[model samples]
Target: MTDENQRVDASHTPLATPGPPGAAPAAPGRARRLAAPVLTLAVAASALGYVAAVDPYEPGHYPVCPLFRLTGILCPGCGGLRSAHAFAHGDLITALGANALAVIGYFVFAGFMIVWLIRAYRGGPTPRLALAPLYWWGIGAVALIFAVVRNLPFGSALAP
Candidate 1:
């Protein structure tokens, strides 16, 4: 190859070229394959277990929403734990009654996790859940609106 065409890739290290001294060997492929699903399941189970046991409805178990306590206004996450607790117990009506928005979010999250777990188990690429800045801003706006509306007399039904 001509000198100009004989390019060297600094990042490329031929096999048998050990990594920097003391660098740990990479994990086995089997370990990597199982990691994602195991971690996801563990996190989900722990969260559900806590919500199922402690009971958010009991006044002392969880802290009150500071914003709601101080300003007497509902916040987006005010009833979220209660909603999760109800959903965990399979009471759809009570879950929705506690916090409809949070209930919807729980289902959306469950759907995404299902996709993620399926992809992980099959060794397929995981789905990207990124949203654009515009979408994030829109979500924030909607939450703010929900909070405001829920505090109003007409939107009392939306309140926890």
Candidate 2:
């Protein structure tokens, strides 16, 4: 055979040696697979820790919500920081009172993180939200409704 043919054959060879017959394919290293989830958890934990240490209840520590300041209307995210502070301090009732929607969001985020960590540990594909357009619109609608309700007199309990 010509050198060109030999080179072509060499190029077609597998990069790694084949494992024993019928053996399952090798997975990524545990550390490599867990890196993203662990890093994400660390970042989240750091942020929560900061919020827990700092007092959002105290003036001047955090910026006021722009929408609430300008319009005097309670936007959906208006009390989110306060909610986080309360949540991090183990005050579930206070957190919910500050912003029920934000409290619910925290739980949803926790659930997603748990699923992601589990899947990553097992070397499975990363978890995706993958919500359809309808679901996206539904989420938007819920936020809008929450904002409106929180601003109304009847929803004073929901206000921060």
Candidate 3:
């Protein structure tokens, strides 16, 4: 397209906004850009808030882990809710004790989200979140080791 047509079209486009004083302008649709990150943060906060308010340690408040109930074995997710509750309540030690794996996952998620939000706000493309197949296998191996060790008589400390 000719420069004149491009200029006219840009002005009429919904995404374009006025430039800052003597600075390069931001991308268009900045308002629309906020929804995804904002919704993600809100959802995360709401879930954490709910976990903070609810006592996961109290029996009957939350459902018992079906796997634990059925097999008497502690699953990887057995103490996840309790871990969330402890983290939300600012008891890092308790949270770690409840589920160290889940705590690690929480930190990983939080870091990913921080990057996601920053990129979103700056109008950059969202970062890829996929892990390589090898990484996934390594994670699975670690979890399997954790599970087997926890279930063994010697690794009761890993149990919730």
- Each model's C-alpha lDDT? 0.84, 0.90, 0.85
Q: Estimate each model's TM-score.
A: 0.80, 0.86, 0.80
Top-lDDT candidate index: 2
| lDDT tens readout by residue for model 2, 1-160 | 5676446565765667458746776887989888988999899999999998998989999999888889899999988889999999899999999999999999999999999989888878899999999999999999999999889999899999
Query: How high is the lDDT of residue 60 in model 3?
Result: 88
TM-score of model number 3:
0.80
lDDT (Cα, tens digit) per residue for candidate 3, span 59-140: 8889998989999989888789999999998999999888889999999889988988888888888778688999989999
The sequence of per-residue lDDT tens digits that candidate 1 reaches over residues 18-105 is: 5775687664475687687779878988998899988998889999999989988789888889989999999999898789899989
RMSD of 1: 5.6
Cα RMSD of predicted structure 2: 3.2
In angstroms, give how far residue 43 of model 3 lies from its true place.
Answer: 0.8
Better of 1 and 2 by TM-score: 2
Q: For each of the candidates, give the backbone clash count.
A: 0, 0, 1
